[model samples]
Target: MRGQFPRVFVLPTKLSPVELDRIEGSVAELTWDAAEAQVFVGKISRRERALFELRRLKVLTTETSQPMRDHRSGIPLVKGAKTSTRRNGTDGPHQYQDTDSAGHDEFQPLRPGHIQVVRLQWLEDSLDAGAVLSTSNYLLYEGIKVENDPQPALAPTQVSQASTDDIAHETSNRPPESSQYSAPSQRLRQGSRERRTSSGGRSIAPQRPVLVHETTSEHDLPLPPIPAFLHTTYSCQRPTPVTTPNAGFVEELKKVRELRLLEGDSIGVRAYSTSIATLAAYPHVLQSSFEVSRLPGCGLKIAELYQHWREHGSLAEAVEGSKNERLAVLKLFYDIWGVGDTTAREFYNKGWRDLDDIVEFNWGHLSRVQQIGVKFYDDFKLKIPRSEVEEIGSVILGHAQAIDGGFQMVIVGGYRRGKAQSGDVDVVLSHPDETKTLRFVEKIVRALEKSEHITHTLTLSVRNSERGQTALPWKGEGRHGSGFDTLDKALVVWKDPEHAKSPHRRVDIIITPWKTAGCAVLGWSGGTTFQRDLRRYCKAEKGLKFDSSGIRSRSDGSWMDVETDPELGPAPDMVTAEKRVFQALDLPYRPPEERCTG
Candidate 1:
């Protein structure tokens, strides 16, 4: 049954996004293009409504006069006024011999290109029966494919600034004129009309910039081949450059993903993450919806979004979310240093619409860290310049070395990934001797605080040192709490005393044993998606558990010697050690710049 089902297309009309995704996933052979579907499944029941849906999809068809017959049984497969049932009350193979004036029994001879519009129940019943059920009881209309009438020429104002080749590529991949799909340009025209009528001739919001013209030819010059690493589902295996041709579109998607996060839609967040990772790795600028549909993790719905974005210069949902008051408030709380989605919703539920509200009404109820977050919310929101980030790292490293001259540090996080500025500073400090690192987090924070460089300690954890600084056993998920990893660390607020006007900044100083410095650096350097996939890749493929603390064999929970080679011995520097760790994991060494799987 895996691939036996007909090519099916589920209409989005009158269905929730969750419902649409569920039905799409249940289909064994779901086709993105309506023109390729042998069956159209939707909630619609009336003949006129079904025909309207077909017209919306640009499916031109001629209604058949005769009832459809099952080729295998040579029996009429049309439902009558009454359905036959077995003794057990299950659907029976009832055949219709006569029809009313409306031709309820009328259906086209189902063939390769002909289509049958059926109620959603057909899918439900087929799954319940564990077989493809006959459509007799569910059929609403049937039609033979027909050639599409000519579309009118585009008006002068309707032309886009896209390259000729891109337009040609879009045209070449378009479904047949009378097929079960409308051209993107045609859809945009219809969408414009709908918006104008619904909103009294004005757009709901200002649109984004038009898609810039692309010069690459889809035919004369081939699309850059997908990198071999991208073939795998793990994003850590792929190279996602910091700058991509699709960065603008990716940012648009990130906004929607962020909205989902604020709305507490975990599934939606994960779905968007996968799509964003895939698109981030794609080298070419998208030219058509078909291009989007073919990419890994991107499906028909995402492709439709790409089409809409290309035509409208913005996603409707993203624009609408930006203007949503609830979402806007949630985003405000979520942006605080120590607040998460759950806490953001909690704040909103308490009627704390802004930082002022929280400060005035719920100041005592907030955690110490969250209270600090609200107090310095404006300062924390300010982007830390690369120069400032480097200065901050230098100051922290200076303090660590003051305690012990052997201390060495590597600034990880976005700064190492080639960002012009970072939201915060993250530096991993280590020493050549194990004794120097044990319980080092407290010493470092105390030193910074004494020097007036540290304003507040958000949270300090010595879990790694308490657990003897070894990789904890892999007890699977839910075994770990908010910290997730057991690296000794300090989350602190820092401000330069040298410059009184400087903004307060968030800084994380992590202390790792010199042996696992590679793991610490690797884990913290990559983007969120890159780090997630790295762990997943390790667990699924290498039978190992990975965290910023260290990597351990899942089979026996023993630490793997990833930083040392039998010939070269231990790596001399943190960066070199990180390269060795990648090699030991059987992963290609991706530079920090190439690990931006956002």
Candidate 2:
């Protein structure tokens, strides 16, 4: 015989059709006598065996019933009996647990070797065999041996106990299912442990990590114990302390908490925290929490506020804690046109805390626009609802579409992003002919102003071409031109109605020609920082400049202007243009909604 005995491998489940064919091919290539052509099958788990039995009956009745004979008797098989003999040297029956609570008496053999082939195919179809073969968990065969004499099978009682023990062991040892199964956090912990072991016999001091805890009442709650792995001794220099304004800093924390609650889980909470951290003078303020929980930088006391917000809308004992006074001061300082946080802080330290104080003592520091900002501080703070934004967009769209037959206008911003409420409206206008957009902006602004809807106007100009260019000296020219060839002329309008006492509602309008529609749409439909990073990526890595106009190469030192003439060929529309840019740079064109980045 080419091989004296047949080797059987256990599988987790039944095989697919493709896998069954592969197993049959391998078996045909092997040379063995009819008596020696024995094949044994094993089940890896009880659940797998149950599933296999269910599929085997279906396959036997549908495909071939003749193959359902018992190997030893050559008769149709019955369950609960040892139908096939073991390899010559084997001493007992293959002891396997009953998969279901019911006995295996219902299970009928479909074929003598069919189950073996099915089991083998199941393993081949489901798993990457190469990956499994390389793993420590997989089984490998070195060789096989057989004896002429066979031994007696095991008793039924002995088989039952062995199967029960296997069940208990598997339940205890199997890993739990988790969201991060592909990129398990345990891998990081393993790496850190490995590093500590390699560093030799030096004792390291543990650093104090911040812990946050939620409060039951007004008083602070105790923090949870640090994880054991974090207690590892390692010496690293402490980071430099950050400076924070002593005046009304606590109140600002409360406002941040309020904003967090109002925004809820959907808004980018981490981004908001990072923005605050970067702006705050004291770095520890970033760590401060209103609740007692495991906030990254905050500890027990601050974690209380976070918990309060989660459970209730307002902080219990902290309602009157400098919040009103601080808001008044902030509102006053924010109105000064040129004055931001840095300038406002200086004024606050000088005892100028209110609008009257700022007007009297800090008039020289304030710009004309800041004076206007101070004048309408209360009105500006009110949020514009989605309904109002829609009304305003419709009004603008009506006027734009009336002027030109080819013009198309789309309302973007938070409304387009599917938010329930919006702060302001952003409308983008484009037309088929590039030349038609030249004087369209001015005409649209005049039309809206005449309707009595536009009460006031601010910052009306085409976005300058030189806005996002790198300042590099040219190799062989008088001067290197800007990266952006076209600029989007934007108009900011203020809508005032007789019903509302407020001065006007803010609306941002952008108009782009057909040639630059793709870049303009992407730039305008932004969460701000996302578009900035995209431009940065194109310039720094791709040696290409991208803006509201089009993409251009630094090497050519020339504009790769998109042909906008529809008569000539296909004009660069949003989808086609973006695809072209991405293809040229060898990067994927991401959808507008997924443009958010770090």
Candidate 3:
């Protein structure tokens, strides 16, 4: 394979320094001088983008009218062939042809002052096939070189968003050369349940249909109007349905985000969070990088990733991150019920690679809660089905009712937000009488513990009741900090005696006064990002303090009556009370299913 490649310049755009080094190291004639290169290799997918990169690099060139062709067959390299159909000469009539470069006659020499821009995948496939593969399907541009006036280096910036604002389109302007690539007849292959990329270790889900309408221009898919609420900075103000067209991509991004958290990259975690939320709200299946770049938080880097995913059926970085040895160990510890990312790293630093390591070496040093987590590590990892979550909620309600018949409960958490399964069960319990709600969590826990339904109690707090059951004062984070909710609550482990084989599940019981029951449900129902934004919206827009306990004036400590109606009087039920909270806050009411902002 030595000296088989021509003078090549690996464009640094969209590639990390390490990745650039890896690609450059493999090329026999890697050149830093753009003028001396015969081929420009990059991850770029479009001819326009290739030209933009050349201009950014200050390489002057004019488009060539004659297309590049194969040397042996003298056939013009076709455009618009899908990458999936480009396997080595077996899959179809137009399957990729491998160009063996054992001698000089196998390859056409570059014409004087001419250059071809090819996809980075061309090099990878050539190396894999042990020959220089024909670049017909991978070629993005061909041009004649010219001298440019020397100018100061330009700051690297992507194409202007204004020019790239189109919603979705194919990679090229030319019509497909084969029927398989035609827009109208092309169908999404529902291949295997999961397919691993040729690179290995990368598992991708089934392909989704490219959402577009058949038209003559091909690049003119009408843009769906951006939802009005998407313009708002706060995710709490918008509706986020659980099911989205870009869910597979979002899931891959989440894995990367989790890796960032484990690695303690706070900025990266927040950046990925914003991008994931934006994609989760997107309604259309993406067809182009331009569509992704136009999204609120997604820019060129994310757009490039979308292009890569479309071509390879998976994100390369995400696959590698999932296989990282350090991250895998960190995730094992992070998944423990009582351990967080910080604690996970702490365990890793202590040479604890798995649960057995912690139990064998550091069992005596482990906290009681963490020890319990280690004991039931596998059991806690199991997801609780919706039916079992409901049954657990019923058992808690039944025990609460045993203490007092007036107790009311509403299942919250992921169950309320339309998840098929949940990691835990959360329920808000209230009584019509505020007096009964005071110190009520203790009674409910005691009753459940007596019945053997409650196995372990992680925490119990009654801060709100002890402080007269009022909303906590609105102080800046510097003063009050992001403390736990002031409401009375109990975190416990539960199991069903009827199903002896049932896995132990985590359950939370929240006690709220009747006046603030709505606040309790609203606070616990939405996703983590949705709740964080709700507090932010209150402080920045509404000038109030929000928590599960209640809402209060920021300037003063007086509790705000968001659950009461001015004309109709107090809310008659909890659901109405929640709606009244939305009304009082001047926010449009969002149903539980629409609060899945994650």
Candidate 4:
């Protein structure tokens, strides 16, 4: 049996040389035994004892090599017994007692020489190896082993004839007591009496005792189970709902399905139009919404819509409000050059709801460019296809190179990312020699304008005086007003006469000098809010000022000297320069496609 049981050896920590030597000696001296053995040096915490007991019990019961069974009946021992017993004077129950011996009376108390109970304890400061050996020996004697044990015996009284009524009455009528044996003893006594009366004096075999073993020290006895009613009294109660007075009308309507989609529903369209109106009328509201939950045009209904979009996967409504003919015509008119909501609304109020009305009215309000925009309104709204963008790029590049041998041009907006179509073409013009940047921009625009490609132009000159101040809107300032000096370049929007006005197509050309090329590229290649965020990060975190020209130091009022060399400069252009800036600030560079807040 010892040989059948596997050996288990454990070490709590790395063994020193001396400890290793001792282990070697112990192993060399261990002799082959039929039963299994394990050697461990670790301290076992109290929590591990129960698990160890279960493992040991399983091994002993199921893995023994010997086929030894009950000596009297030659049957295997029963497992998982609910009942077992030992006479008061009998040897304390052996760990692995057999169970098939009926009509046997071999069980007897510990005789003068048959049994021994030895107790020993180690001194508090003891370090003697001999004391450890003694403890091990005593443990070995008490340890359960199946090979050397005797069969288990039954009790002296059976309860087979006890009526169900009598058993129930006996259990219910019993009083709680501190005595260890009182309850079982009373039950057994009642059962015995009832059996005798029911059987009419015939002698019967005694029943098994319901044995229970508990290992607590005398200082720790088991407590009784608590009554069910006592537990219920201490449990937590459910919370009551509280009423709120300020909940909005839409919220108060339990069955309301407030629509909130970007492009489809009537309510969503109104909400979106309201948002756009709010942004145009009160741009400050955009910044305010980031901090507080309340703002003009941002009522509970809209807030609820934004919150729902952020949390749930779907919106309840879409943004194309009831399709009014006037609204559609106004939307179409707003797409033209030099026109805005105010002008569109003015036209609507005057009964000029369509393009034909504006043409027929023949007003002084329509400028030459606006007239062209109205003429080609449909085509201008359509995105410029990739092939057209390339063709336009070739035209601009050829014209630019022809003006100066040193000139270079790059397509820098969404088109640069290889998009299928573009809203407008953004070209970055530069030269290797920084001194010629001003001349380069002037000559390219001149050359393009001479080709009859220029239809309209808005030129802004950079205000060097306002370089140190921030551009954020201040109190009392109008929404569209940014009180900063303008740049010295022209923003030319033109119609391609070849791509005529039945669907009038237009191109926007932004020309900036080489000195502010990087900043200009970043500014124009915008999903507007993204560029704003990048600028904010530069100002707040890096203590650097960013604008169309370049990044500069805020503390000492010095410019960042970014050389124009292909390999050594901050970057070849603005896109790479922005990546470098973000990397320097330890932020991931967000790609253009993901820039849309929607």
Candidate 5:
């Protein structure tokens, strides 16, 4: 057996005071990656004890480690960290303290007769500590059990009195005892009870759902297992009751989805969105990775990643990728209202790392809209609660009516889709007389711009993208606009008039000719994928064109003037149009709330 000489194993830290202190002082940016803490400390080629003893590899005790210091600066590494005077002529100027595993000393050199198994494990603060402590899921070497102590080894007060401004404020280097790491004995070798993974790998309890394949004999087509109380893959098939049973899983996937989005991976975002929507609609607690892999939106890649989570009780990819330096910087710039994914990447390529970089050195390159985005980065990050969205909608509604009582407004987008908080508020505006609404966008901007609640005008236009016509809602190649950016709209910054520190939120007002009010509302009320599929269904299946304004017949390139024609009109409106669009495509109508697709 080839034994590696003694080397210090630096376990990656998360929410602990040790890590938080580093971040607070800007000394080290703590990595949120789950896998960083799980890498093999040393790869062993053979397990024979006689061969290993011949190599004379040394064991490292974490407790005996001395504090590390910079070579030039000679500054202490971690604050309040105890330093040892004894240094065994190490190469670096400083050395870390030597100690056993925080939870136990099970992590030791494997004997000639034993095979050491390195597995991912989760460590949690004891439940008896008044509050359920956040999970500190990590990989633990030297196989252990899956339980935790009920009492915390270290208290918050121990960390509270430390210097908030120093990275060296760690209270103790000793890790708490964990219940998950079980010392391997004779019983562990006889793997009769646990589900065995392939190739003598670590095994965890499997929670595979009994999949009852629908019509086990009839259909030649391959289909996924039907989950309990569900038959169709489309989200609209079920009520998708509003609940938070799958918040952790959903949130983890969303971070990935958002990461993909920031990196300009449109296809990846769409794929992840499908899974996100499915997980959000699921009712049961996700007990195992197998259950998540079987769901409609998930594929093998996602399934495998989730399996790691099931084994460790922590998301592996989420732990590592979310804090990736490039991705983090990209997300910061990409989230700016004016910046698109393409633009965000461009900024990154130019060495613009963050808002500060843009403001300090490259301010001249920013467009007017980007300047506004930079100015209110923090405000835009704040979500607008459902109540605040309604308040803003009411303000806009009141303004529209005052201009012309005939004009109508309907809040669409995420707010209309039942989200408790939305990144921005979408409100659709229309008037029966298409001529009167021709320039209503300009009028609304003028009116809203005067209000104390309006902080900045991000965008205002008659027809953004200014394309004459489209096959769908901006889907074709060389598309002139941000697929949904072509409609006549006003995008503004809004805040509560009373509170000076109120969050500045994004609000969009779309104006459609009253003749096509229904089509407009249908277009704007999107979960992204739903709208894309809806349009594709129109063009390919029905030979009909669909967009924000109205539907048109592809046969002769003529508007489907259902409402304007007296013979067809019972004074048709948005609701009637929405239903007819579904009918024209021979699809069951899904409500605005159920369009949580893509």
Candidate 6:
């Protein structure tokens, strides 16, 4: 065993289908700017050795059905138990008093229905053996000998626990029927929702299907034999307009989108987005799942969902999510800025009931941006009228011109795309001088605040793309990665100075070099799915990286020439570069107004 595992190894972990799918996409399948995640299982000793040496890889025991025991007391925690917090070093109401081998209390109370995360204490490869150990109250999973176990059986297994007749009622292992599914669902949420892309403030609401580059024909319903042209995979090929053909049906799909997003399945979210866009643009009412399957984006899964919609009138996942307390709380909490579904789950685990609860006890742990978000959640939820956005835009533009006469700003997002009401305003600014753009966010924000219009600044990030200039790189660092390529960005809470106590609105001020300003305008002017597909198209087909800042040839890692002059004068013209990006990628030039991927 020692030789086989190098005296230290990670066990062959049990994984879910979704987990496998997430880890499955690697260099060949994944996009350029996605987080690194993958999983494979086989001979335990062999596989663990390969991964353990990587140092950064995290090892976790897939959640088991019954509650597991603590290493110290060998006593199992109740189903869904929470950790006891101490005030002034005194135990809270639900404290676990289990004692250790030395007759001292020691436990890292395992909550029921959640997987136990184990930390390795020493170099040892016996993780897959049996009977977990405890150091500082850690509970280890004692692996069973799987000699030649089939792969399928290794999926989340039902852990066995001794009869809890002797256990106290408050700390029993028996769980409700709902708890059984809760574990996997929470795991899925945990695995997926941590690093999700925000899907709002993109373009006009109720987006229609995409107007493809060269396609002449449009989707005509109530006819036999669907045209081959109507079934192209690309969203750009189809004419998706703002008129929602199937609003009720699309609403159901939105729930799926919500679940996928909450689970952190960005790819899945994208998959649904394509289908949603196609269906939204569909000119005719979808009468059946068979009809849905015939559409451009729908495949087996989407077809099944359509079938469910026809027969049951709703999705099973939607029904389940509506009932899951945890999911509901997570959905509500996820609205806060800088707070993802993962952070929401952590808050739930801490017994945080509402925003006030979080504020009362957990204010310090939250990022400064998130605190601002919490303070103005209700105000941010209120939509901004086109007139209001225009006023805000004019104010920002006027402020910029005051600071620098040549600075120009355009409202992108929903307002630029002609939405009646928008969740937030996304304004893209540009200046001829790259130096001026460097600290443009700071100056503009200062100017806006002076007008008493910019109420609060949520986040300010300036690009210090000079390699090795910033602190340790975050996960999934790439030109088009998690945060996306940009010059400088400021997320702020805003309200009109005239309406002093009026509802606050979310505003994103994006400062870009004149060279890549067009792309920035194009990327930020979104119907969420439209931007997603744009990135997908650029990456998969062209092997070029496309972000707001500029396009980079994936081959050479050098930026495409969107700039006219490298000298410190006015930045390169984006009008030329915008058209050039389309030409270079061999795609039809789509004007900002036509780009909507909601």
Q: Which candidate is the best by lDDT?
A: 1
TM-score: model 2 vs. ground truth: 0.44
lDDT, residue 37, model 4: 27
Candidate RMSDs in order: 12.6, 24.2, 19.3, 33.5, 21.3, 16.9
Choose the strongest candidate by TM-score.
1
Which stretches of candidate 3 lie above 4 Å from their native place? 1-218, 480-484
lDDT of 3 by residue, 1-598 (tens): 4226766777654455446535533443454445456888876665656766676455678789976555555566554533233332211223233343333232346789988887777777676566665566566688888765444433344344212521132234323332111221121111123323222323333233233222344347666776666656577788889998988888887876776677554445655676787788787888677777667656544666677777777777578766766668878999998899878877876667788899899989988788888888888899999998998888888888888898888999999999999998999999888889888888889989888888899899888778767556656544652334778999888887677998888888999988899999999999887887787778766778798878877777567878877788766778888888888888999999988877
Off by over 4 Å in 1: 1-224, 481-483
Winner on TM-score between 4 and 6 is: 6
How well does each candidate superpose onto the true structure, as a TM-score? 0.67, 0.44, 0.64, 0.42, 0.57, 0.60
Q: Comparing candidate 4 with candidate 5, which one achieves the higher TM-score?
A: 5
lDDT of 1 by residue, 1-598 (tens): 2114566667655555556555644553555456556888876554555665676666678787876554334456554534342222112222332221122222233586688887676677666555676666566678888775334433444344223443464467665532223343333212222122111222122232133333346335455665566556678888898888998889988987786577555545656777898899888888776677667666555676787788798888798877766667778999987899888877776666789898899888889998898889899999988999999998998888889999889999999999998999999999988888889899998889999999998889999899777656666545653226688999999988999998899999899988899999999999988897787778767888888877778787667778977998877889999998999899988999998888
Task: Tell me how many residue pairs clash in candidate 6.
Answer: 23
lDDT of 3: 0.70
Higher-ranked by lDDT: 4 or 6? 6
Give the residue spans of candidate 6 off by over 4 A: 1-232, 236-238, 263-270, 308-316, 464-483, 563-577
The digit string of per-residue lDDT tens for model 4 on 278-363 reads: 22222121211121123322333344444443445333322222243444555666777667655665565566657888988855
lDDT of 5: 0.52
**Model 2: ten consecutive residues of lowest lDDT:** 232-241
Question: Which of candidates 1 and 4 is the stronger one according to lDDT?
Answer: 1
Could you tell me the TM-score of candidate 1?
Answer: 0.67
Per-residue alpha-carbon lDDT of model 5 for 419-469, expressed as tens digits?
889999999988776666776888888887787667777778876324433
Q: Candidate 2 on 499-560: residue-level lDDT in tens?
A: 67654555778877666666666666544444544554565456666666566666765445
